[model samples]
Target chain A: MKLQRVLQYAKTLLSESIDAGDIAIDATAGNGHDTLFLTELVGEKGHVYAFDIQQQAIESTENRLKENGVSHLATVILDGHEHISQHVQQQIGGAIFNLGYLPGANHHVVTKSNTTIEAIEQLLQLLKIGGIIVLVIYHGHEGGKEERDELLKFVSSLPQKYVHVLRYEFLNQKNDPPFIVALEKVKNFPKE
Target chain B: MKLQRVLQYAKTLLSESIDAGDIAIDATAGNGHDTLFLTELVGEKGHVYAFDIQQQAIESTENRLKENGVSHLATVILDGHEHISQHVQQQIGGAIFNLGYLPGANHHVVTKSNTTIEAIEQLLQLLKIGGIIVLVIYHGHEGGKEERDELLKFVSSLPQKYVHVLRYEFLNQKNDPPFIVALEKVKNFPKE
Candidate 1:
């Protein structure tokens, strides 16, 4: 299978639950690929809240959405995903996070562990039952390792009564091929 | 998604490569679930080499296959999979291993890391190009953790040029849910 197989698999998983008019989030709108995918999945009535700290990334995503004529379905935000709770009040149907620095942008400005964990926490609270959060982890660059390690730790600690977290990664690949970490909120999740 | 979603996902991945009338193996025929699955996938012309250390498992698998009217396509062996190379000399298209003791059987008799790893090594040699090995790891019982740890280490060390190892595991699950580790041989594998 190709390296892109995991992404395809992620889309399949999301498509199983998400339908037209559902609300989705692009936790990291790098290059707008995921944002565009979400827009198409959510259709016209649905809304997508996309977050990116880089202005260039937000602009690029906005342009890509406009090009695809799906801009109406998305709200592009030039802010950290850690602040997701402040912007999104609707129950989320699904969310996607492509973790790492924006490609072709300043590599120094990266997604940190604290913010990622916080964003995930907020997303979990706002997630509808059976909703999923997909994380594509790219940990080959500087600071990437730390983010991956911390995220895995945090994800592993999530209570099972609420959600199921899945980690899909290639074990034998070199240069740290990107992996996917997904969380699907359980049906009839117990109240904490 | 249900708890069996990962298993279904594993079947999907295997179906991508395996075709009718192809040789396959069930390294651990626990209750004949995978054995039956492989038998159907391989069809009437293809053969399936099924191994289980427990006679009960072999008998169960044999009975299940007979009930399904596909017993002719399978050879049930009441032996460990570590000796798979000795019985089967032909190249294998795909293999499945449900690690841990057979459910409802004697839970003490478990698939240890040493023999499990040995079977995997042999299978790697026998796997045809584009063939896959699907491992459903049940690492919650006694000796399960060690096997999981050692197997992860072993799989992580496999050369990327030869095979791609994919791990699918849930992070937030009580009682340690089973995970899948798959290895797909590369089409243009380098000659060792």
Candidate 2:
């Protein structure tokens, strides 16, 4: 598989064979690739809540979904990190975040580690048992490395009983295009 | 989580709930990271059948495992693609192939699509229901694009009912370091 195919493999690992009515979340809906994938995986009966800080991103994703005849299954939000918890009401089966700027757009207004960390904290809480959150970190630009490093630290500290965290990257790569950091909530995550 | 942590994630996805007595296969035991992970996941009662075409690879993996005190739980073989079925007698819980050649070693002697495709077919027959096969394909070098493209085409053509296939890659990256392709044999895979 090439670079794009790896994300799909991660999605499959996070997918469950349960009924299609289960909810899913897209923490970042850049160009709607993941949002579209999740919508298909969850089927017509399912619901998808997508978030993006950029209006351009939201509009592009919305157009993509509508053009593909899947807009009914998705709800795109044009808000930053803090709005996700209040916007998405359902206990989701899985959530995904592509943590970088929208491809082919302004790279300067990219994701910050603080907001991403906050958004992830809320997303994890919203996940159900056996649910997963996939965070794809891209550290090629100026602020990228800090976000990647901080996110790794945060995920590494999550308790083992409640979650299993995994990071995927190629050490040989020079500029650090991006890598995958996935969190799977154990089926029996301990209750407080 | 660094690069090794990604392998840890792969390990959890493939063998999270498997007991201590399950059989597993490390198709490309390069440097033995996945081999050792498989050994630990399977426990002492279980067994891991690891394969590598290169004598240097098998020897290096064996040494790594022995140093880690896990050689007893795994059986390292100095055979290529076609020998997996002969080496593993029991139904496998999971099989993993880090499909590119040995890293930091000669890039000339890498995995070819022909042998890999054949091996995948055989392993599919050997896998138990609900079993998984993960292929981490690196398409960064010469001849990589052809192999990767062929493998993707092969996996994508699989029927929907029996086996669910997933391809994961970072869409935003160049050089396309490597990505993941996974196949899960459903419980009700066609028996006829």
Candidate 3:
């Protein structure tokens, strides 16, 4: 198909923003897929921060990274992504958030809009100019719709002069499929 | 920006489907920019069909194609796009529609939802497998919103087994910014 699927398109944006030796983040490390992908994109010289609130997610991500021999390149944190600002101090090339519950895990433990927004706010401050923060939103489960709607509202209100918000989705699919919302920082916000 | 803007994304999809020696169509023609582009996409050995209801649009498109030294590559027709099947019978590699009133033209004389859907229906039938139809939707003017809504409803209902309907838009911008809805035919439909 000429149109890229949601997962492929998410990587495309992240790959475009990140180069070898650049810093990246997997906001919700889930099954360690994106974290591992980030390690490959940034290479050994670079660093990745994988955050997950659940111990199972963190352990799985760490094992996957170590099995690939890139464990040292990423710091797996067992904490909510809302505490990202506390963990990451340096500028980042790109970040990705798979905003839903972990697959095969508890369905109720999904990412909420408030903490997601807080994490996004901190990421925006940490993102260098031209860097992107991609959100792959899955809204099929209970409470998913509310998170998606609230996040859309917040992102839509972001000033165009400082940010560019892109919404890419497939409209004709059956199940409520996940879509991508990418935020690119064009200019620095006034020091607050 | 890593995320392609509306116009560029439309061209990207069209270019992907069209080859040097294939047929293409500019469903709206408008100011002739996309018509001229279609001519270039299909080289000297190929053909393009440009349709518009306004005489001024046909004239401008003709002039533009002539100035570009490719007027012979296209057949400029002064008629509504709903009558597309009557003018062309060959399978098309790709097509594009700039839906709504022609830019810089009278806003009152806008393209309606029914006729636009008719044109789309005909285009889908004529599109070869893997061919695409791109619609750059501008819905700020009078009657624009209605057309946009109706078009979305129609496109969203297209069977995913044979077609992939992609909606690409930037949501942070103020002025009702234009967005893209690209339909790619992945498989042939059963004969009716």
Give TM-scores for every candidate, taking all chains together and pairing residue i with residue i: 0.90, 0.53, 0.99
Q: State the TM-score for model 2.
A: 0.53
Residues B1-192, candidate 3: write the lDDT tens digits: 777778888889999999988999999998899989998899998999999999889989999988999989999999999999999999999999998887677777788999999999999999999999999899998888989999999999999999999999999998799999999999988899
The digit string of per-residue lDDT tens for model 2 on B68-184 reads 998899989999866787777677888898877798789998999988988888888877777778888888888999999898888777664566675444332335556777677
> Which of 1 and 2 is the better model by DockQ?
1
lDDT of 2 by residue, A31-96 (tens): 988888888888899988888988888998999999999999999998886678888867888888
Per-model lDDT: 0.87, 0.76, 0.94
Clashing pairs in 1: none
lDDT of 1 at B82: 97
Residue A159's lDDT in candidate 3: 92
Question: Model 3: C-alpha RMSD to truth?
Answer: 0.8
Docking class of 2: incorrect
**Tens digits of lDDT, candidate 3, A1-192:** 888999999999999999899999999999999999999999988999999999989989999998999999999999999999999999999999999899989988999999999999999999999999999999999999999999999999999888999999999999999999999999999899
Query: For candidate 3, what is the TM-score?
Result: 0.99
| Number of the predicted model whose lDDT against the real structure is largest | 3
Each model's interface RMSD (Å)?
2.6, 12.8, 0.7
Candidate with top TM-score is 3
